[model samples]
Target: MSSNSSIKCTVKKPVEVKISDTKSSLCSGLSIVDLSFPNNSEKGIQQIESISFKNAYTAFLTIKVKSEQNSSSTGGKWKMCLHRYQLMTSPHYESGSQDYFKIPSSQMLFVPQDVVSVRLILQQPSSAWNQFGIEQVSIETPTENTNEEEAISKWLQQHLNLNSTVKKKIENVEVDEVSGGLHRMWALTETVKAQQTSASLGRYEVDDSYEINLLSYT
Candidate 1:
């Protein structure tokens, strides 16, 4: 009997993907953010084992100490717990910062292939005046590279499943980078109709504008 040693996978270049359309409200108690990509045929959402934040900070939004409130007050006891998780992994809490904080790579844990989500849970203590806040937030993950032609082939096969000739024509189309990072790959010949339809259906249009993080892959 043969035993499988491991499942090896390579982390590729980061690609810009739309996670959310707008910024969320500042939630202090418990906030859950969805990190899945939009559902589309041409897109393959990256499976992340780790992530990092550009800036993460927790501080006192406002501190009001009442004369009546003593050292035993409950306000001084609440603290923020920064946690990240996937479906299979346990919540990894970040520590070591009562003020500005950034998670170092050494402290990061593995995120699963399942959708990644983050939560900021509020921990209350025995004293008073313990409100906390987080801001300047950014989320990131490493992505794998994709072959442009393979993407185009898959898109065309969606429509031309019966017409191999048309599929060949579409595949034969060549493009050159004419200006400012735009690849002139669209064909205006008889294949124009096919191109237009494929585009509207969310076919290929390269969007490589995103920050990349070159961390050691696990």
Candidate 2:
């Protein structure tokens, strides 16, 4: 995962739209082409879906918002999306919401595509002049193969560092070979004593005795 880029933003008002990156609008707005305006009352009326690239395996965006103080509408939800599939939904905001939050590919079980594009959909948003700003959009490229097993193994190793720095003597004990469950078990050895004797009191009145021994096991 490498390569990152930010998408250009187009700001819109109730009347028209344009391909401009200047922060002329204070807070909120919708995405649209020039001369096209979306219904402000409608939820998610604007969608930025044209940030296309090659070999993008993961994508994320930065959002900036101005919290509502005494406004009629509370801050609304927005989506970090791939096509129409959303990878994340922003939490409701009442005050200013500005941060660089990451939207990873794993959220939507996203697989790398040769031609990949990400879209940000704003739903029930307040005016762009007052509410939110789309900051930075980025996508990551897959340099290596990715799989569920490999991802899970990597996550477990990162969080559970049982054998990270130092090697343990009792490791990878196959507790259940049939089920393929692994654990750590002690490698123990012990010794035991055993004796055997025999005596006869008949005939020649002779007695014989023998000693037996047992060895360590497991």
Candidate 3:
């Protein structure tokens, strides 16, 4: 069986972001802003495609996920997916302030499955900025069409079950050498023709009147 087929599947829904009520500060001068997903279903999130958010004076960001091994289980442990990821080049400056950012799945340490909740820990080391937090936070996952296409492709591959002889025959198929040479020659001629630019009359005004409206600088 394929690796994808071996993994457990669940019903997926849109993820919602909610600000956690519990707020606290660390002794290391780090301002914490906690965010959670309130509308996650019992099955929880299956996959994460990307995460987008607007930074608000936040220099660094840390992400953690809470997931349950079994949906029936009431408890789950927290796992760190992103640790002390830089959000800005300079904390004191407004380089990345209020700027939108999208972190793709490739950057994540690991893609968590059956994610019950997500936590975002924002930090601003410098005291120069009094306020710091993330805005317009959103989590994106693979669409239903993507999953459907994958399933269809897998099913087709499995059902077809082509033999090595047939596969070798298909792979060994060759194109007509004459036709290939003609195509290459045609392509080269088209490229040469495209490089030769046509010259036009340098006339801008039509009958001593401008074609476009002239801007009046007051």
Best candidate, lDDT:
3
Alpha-carbon runs more than 4 Å astray in model 3: 1-28, 70-75, 146-218
Better of 1 and 3 by lDDT: 3
Question: lDDT (CA) for every model shown?
Answer: 0.33, 0.33, 0.68
Per-residue error (Å), model 3, residue 177: 19
Off by over 4 Å in 2: 1-29, 32-96, 109-112, 127-131, 145-218
Please give, for residues 161-208, the per-residue lDDT of candidate 3 as tens digits: 656666666567676866799899999999999998796543455566
On TM-score, the stronger of 1 and 2 is 2
Query: So what's the TM-score on candidate 2?
Result: 0.27
Better of 1 and 3 by TM-score: 3
Error of 3 at 45 (Å): 0.7
Would you estimate the TM-scores of all the predictions? 0.25, 0.27, 0.53
Candidate closer to the true structure by TM-score (higher is better), 2 or 3: 3
Model 1 RMSD in Å is: 29.3
How are the candidates ranked when ordered by lDDT, highest leading? 3, 2, 1
Clashing residue pairs in all predictions, respectively, total 13, 6, 0
